[model samples]
Target: MTTTTSDGVATTRPAGQQPDPAHGPGTATRPRGRRAALRPGSHLFLVLTAAYFMLPVWWLVVAATKSNTALFDGAHGSMWFDDDVSFVDNLVQLSTRSDGIFWRWMGNSLFYAVTSGVGATVLAVLAGYGFAVYRFRGRNLAFSILLGAVMVPPTALVIPTFVMLANAGLTDTRWAVVLPSLLNPLGVYLMRVYIQDSIPPELLEAARVDGAGELRIFARVVLPLLRPAVVTVLLLTMVAAWNNYFLPLAMLNDPDLLPITVGLGQWQRLSSVGSGGEQVWNLVVTGALVSVVPLVVAFLCLQRYWRGGLTMGGVK
Candidate 1:
């Protein structure tokens, strides 16, 4: 027997079979009862996982709202906001500290993340497309080298990178971080896989037959189709660049050139023995909170693109 759903998909079932206990009578409903039984357990697992990740963020939020005195006071609540709100005060303190150097670190982070993300995405697209479409000498060998690079840890390359940058007189500058960030081997691999799977050779052939040059064809035809992969690479590269610490720490000695990640670490260290030899936990918490807000906002705003990109890439 067959019946049409409200959405007009026809579903069929064998004769003499009763309706599923969880859903209606249809072939698709066979797993419904079992899935229903497992739903609560799955939901509980998801909730617990989410809470595990979010608990630290929640603690930071609550801590950001408390005064230094309240934070250290045994009588005050630890996980909740203290009696006197200190968020505004903390913000004021953080902004005025070190001649507003925290804002400079934020600007540096923005520059590095945005530029590196865009540059890396573009390079990945070009490299991925080349690897996927063109037959060349040592292509497999080159991609194998890329895969090997992916296996190697970034920390292992820091000393070597610093030496190279130092030799080129690029250390202690913005490019110290941005240049290294633009070389995302994983992004290239992802784009190669995505392009090979998602884009059909027939499309390229048709474009070629239509008298389009390789650059034109790629720019006009292929790029539109590769939006999902591009966005994914962009987000990944941006997040990595934004959160980068070690390279920046090793390469940049000037405080004026540090990214927010490194800058915040310095602040945390300074907080342990603040100016005039006093601990300044309020500034540290507030600065950390402020540093997080931009990245959080970026993720929230761009999440739709990120999600759609992943979904399309997966489906294709």
Candidate 2:
């Protein structure tokens, strides 16, 4: 069939068919799009990934509430809480163990993490900005060294670092742990990349034209733009410092100076040895749970910055 409009343009269609104004070809396509959007394997993978990460945390929470006997007993499932609620009792025991030294370990961890995190952030920003913005002698060689440093396993350098610290008479001191954490090559590299991509050179030129010095330009202009990268380096260095084990173990023999990682290993050993008929399994479990709380809280508090860092820092 054919029809003519006022403009005398002819159209053809099936004898009894008319076009629906609202639902054209899209009516058929919308259903296909909806079907294509829902992938069973993708949903399954997401569910499994979430469970894989969450199950250990759930076990920790459950295990913290149980007594050592219940924790080891086959009667209760590891995924759920037993009838006994011993979190408060475990806290008391953990606090009093070794004359309140566990709290001291916690304090030491906080100090090291915060101090090294700040120092690493500062140094990384300065070095990375310089690498990205400046032209200097041996610039490529220096950055190549940094990238090579990133590839070297930190564990491989622990012995050398310990020897250097010992020679300087800084072994067994808080500086032993903190000083090593300040030189994060990965942080410098990340900052350099972030600055190169996100910051415009014209802005720096304008700042320089207005009589702003390099330090002033960095402190005022570039730093604000690098907030995401700075936060990223801060969190990475802090987590590394907090969870550090081998360096402190190699450097310090003093129990009072030990971070939670080494200190908890001591408790774990004591738990296994059953020295003086005292079992520390409960204390170790509780302490592990307690130790994780700070990092979790930190992540929650600064998660917005973390998310922004992922977007801006090319981490995603």
Candidate 3:
């Protein structure tokens, strides 16, 4: 006999035999629904992971609001705000301290990060597109070298970079920082992989067939599809440039050219000196809090592109 199952699929069975539970109509749907459900343990793990990451940020926020005395005294403990709320005072101190040099450091960081990030992103996109699309001599060999470069730790190269910059008489200048920051092998690799996976060669061929030149085809067709990867690489390069410490430290000796990372380190070292040193921990903490705001804003602004990319990938 034939009967319609719950999924509307018709099945045949013997006259007196019941449907087999293993091959029942709703069995497939049941497993799918079950697979979608999260167990209590999974929920617990997610909550714990979130807390682990957020706890330090929470402490930083609370510490930023506390007075120097309260910060060291543990009066309200470390995780909660002190009653006095010196956040405004800290900002004022940060603004006026050292002839408002903190703002200069911030401006330096902004310049380095933006210039390097844009340059790096442009290079990565171009190189990645070329690697993904065109078949050139030594393409695989060049990519292999790039992959090897990515495996080498960036810190390992700082000394050699400093030596090179010194040889070129570029040390202690902004170029020393910006120039080194522009070479992001990992970003290039990421873009290459993303382009290969997301952009089809047929689309480019179609654009060419429609009488589009290489430049026009890239700008009109390929670039629009590369938004997500572009944003990702931009953010990564910007953050890397902004947070760069060792390279800048080794390269720049002038206080006026220091980025926030090295500037803060200077303050920290001064604070650590025994009796003759000044204690500017409040300014340091406040400066750190302020430095983090730009990056957080960048992430918030660019997060939609990431979500959209994931959604598009899922659809494809």
Candidate 4:
């Protein structure tokens, strides 16, 4: 049916039909103009956040290109490069400096990180599985205490840990750093929560009925299922251990015992008080750049684990 108004514009409707106000069927929906545009605050926030993080990294890269003389000569902006990029040269020097001690620090960092990540993951898995499956005395209370301990800054424990190590004669040794980092309260808590939500008790009971011992059940059944959570605890604890500074700083004294974090810090301090009493800015910047590479590599290599772990950790 068709109707013509007094102004002579015609409207049409078939019998038993109604017009929908939203849109014509053939047209794609469009936004209501400015409201759909990026909000100024969000855009500004993203830009600021990007700059805040990337600025220092940019400066590190650019500064590696310039000689130390150009740093404070007002030659260019902090993030801008001078005519020559001595970055490769600096990298070579960094490798050979002090009998290639940089590689030793790098190896030490790896040893500490891998050792800690593995230890933390295994401990977390056991503690978490125990918390989820067992009914023991003071279980909840113990868990609550453990979770509470996570809130206490790890840094606050450094001095006490150092003192303990000193008495135990572990000071200035690899054990001083690695032993302390082995157990992470946060990782344990996370594993507990993950296990409680992800693994059903019935599965373990069934596994037991099928003639599996505790360790066998854990290895053959639970480990595969818990891989994602294990990865999460491993990655987080690994990053924590890799980026750790204060504990190692407080625990170990010998330069040979230093991890990259402490070693780079040593270089930074040396930058300020060379034989000539002036900073070696080039070494500082180059060392900073090189030190971050392993961290980047670790993340890049295991990024898939991180992504999958997060996805699975949310399972109920």
Candidate 5:
């Protein structure tokens, strides 16, 4: 009845040659070969989704290898190249373009992503911890307000935010992007739920009896326990901040202040008009590929931290 998957998860398979169609509609199963445990349709959807996502990426990979001319050659398969490979040349060009300003934009993005991620994570954790641990007056009311904020779309506030930032004379600066992204209402809510379920009250009480200050207790006792939720919130916030397009587009008029997202848009617009022509499509494709790398790396590298018993401390 028990079969181990590649990742070592033990799954239960029923004893039958034919699938139990009555078990559920569109959900089928069989006990044959590698298909013994795997539901018949499990892999079909997964493979389809994988192909759907990877197609454009495959195209980008192939396209990045070709010159602009090969890109426009209609006879060539969209996923294949028939011309000179210039991935290296394009990368070199990308690196050296505009007095090496691409690197500057990259650094700015890293700074914004890292700083805002850290700040947002900390605020989320503390706020969530407070919501979980403290029962002050209006706690539910305050949490309800946070839940409401989560429902409110961020784009709806763009103009009002712009007006406020303009009034404060903070527009066209890195702070303009960094400041707004630091507050994640959903992240705060998520942290609260995570802390409530994962953090141990007894542990906090034990620390308090031992004369641990709130901040000290958090640093030495709670943080290590909340690592998974912390990683989850941090990664989510980082991706959000890094991919933020509209906020930056509205606040930053100066090209120097633009993040890669906005900067890439500029390239897309410019490429449409000049020698880039149809070839500029590759830049957009290539840029998209490059932009996704950091997020993938972050997820892979930090996934371990996000896997532990994040609710161990919060449960009764």
Candidate 6:
């Protein structure tokens, strides 16, 4: 078929066919123009953000390869490795120093992070599910209180937590750290929101119609659907427990019980004190590098779940 417009431009199409979408008015050209306008700025922003974050990690890597003298002496710049690289020497010193207490601190951090992460996730899942699924008297009030609790800073509660732990004879013990870490209000909030958004109530009602008990429905249906959110909450709580400093610092007095954060802080203080104090800045740098590896690996491994969860929640 052929047609002529008022401007006398001839157009042709196959018999009984529609106009080609690619040649449609403003369809391809408008999108291409918008993309062309946005791409440069977006690319620049992403590149700058990546450089900002990776710069510190790069410096840590370079510093870890240098010796104590090379670090302070300007033999090489802080951002580059020296010719006389002493990474092995630094690791050896790290292992031998203070009767290998660094390993103990690493182990303590792992324990606290894992224990608290799992504990907080379980509590959050149960609480969130209940909030999303069941309704009872004072439900709104209870949740309101929970939201208010979330607003209260964790640091502000540390003093009262310490007092209560001291009274319970748990201060300076691992429980003092792990117990306090398990109360993750943010995790609970996240789980509740995720549940409400992701899980359909009709699905649960269908499962109930099939004679599945509440526990069975949760285990068989809800959990499978909640995998992404669960992983997100787990990773968040784990990271929080891993990075927690003030709570452990106040609760623990024993060096043997200290996590990497406080242990490294002690070394930092010792290095800064006086001329007589030992300068283990190289060791400190190396330890910090080692401390970061687990978190990096964890993020790399779990990023798929994190991204999937966010995408799912956003879609819902």
Error of 6 at 199 (Å): 2.0
- Model 2 lDDT per residue over 152-238, tens place: 998888899999999999999999998988889988887887788668899999999999999999999998877756777788788
Taken over the whole model, the C-alpha lDDT of each candidate is 0.80, 0.81, 0.82, 0.76, 0.74, 0.83
Model 5 per-residue lDDT tens digits across residues 1-316: 2446568985433212112344521243343475557675988999999999989778877877766666778346778875577788767667777776676777778888899999998999899988998899999999999988888999998889999999999999888888898888987877776666557799999999999998899889988877767776787788788888999999998877778888888878878765564435666656666777777776666554432222222232
Model 6 pairs in collision: none
Q: Which regions of candidate 6 deviate over 4 angstroms?
A: 1-49, 307-316
Judge candidate 5 at residue 312 and give its lDDT.
22
By lDDT, is 2 or 5 better? Answer: 2
lDDT of 6 by residue, 144-189 (tens): 8988888899999999999998999999999999998999876676
Please report how far candidate 5 places residue 177 from its true position, in Å. 0.5
lDDT of 5 at 148: 86
RMSD per model, one decimal: 8.1, 12.6, 10.7, 13.0, 8.4, 10.8
- lDDT by residue (1-316, candidate 4, tens digit) is 2346458975432211122223432122435585578699998999999999888888887888767777766356776887666778787877888898888998889889899889988988899888887899999899889878878988888898888989999999999888889868877776776666567789999999999998899888887877766776788878888889998888888888798889988777766754454576777778788778767777677665564444433232
lDDT of 3 by residue, 224-315 (tens): 88876787677778888988899999999899999999999999888886846789888889999999998888767666544333332213
Q: Which candidate number has the best lDDT?
A: 6
Better of 2 and 3 by lDDT: 3
Instruction: TM-score each candidate.
Output: 0.83, 0.82, 0.81, 0.80, 0.80, 0.83
Residue 153, model 2: lDDT of 92
* Per-structure clash totals for the candidates: 0, 0, 0, 0, 7, 0
TM match of model 4 to true structure:
0.80
Write model 1 residue lDDT over 1-28, tens digit each, in one string.
2457679985432211223333434445
Which runs in model 1 stand beyond 4 Å of their true positions? 1-46, 273-277, 304-316
lDDT of 6 at 224: 84
By TM-score, highest first, what's the ranking?
6, 1, 2, 3, 4, 5
lDDT (C-alpha) at residue 259 in model 4? 88
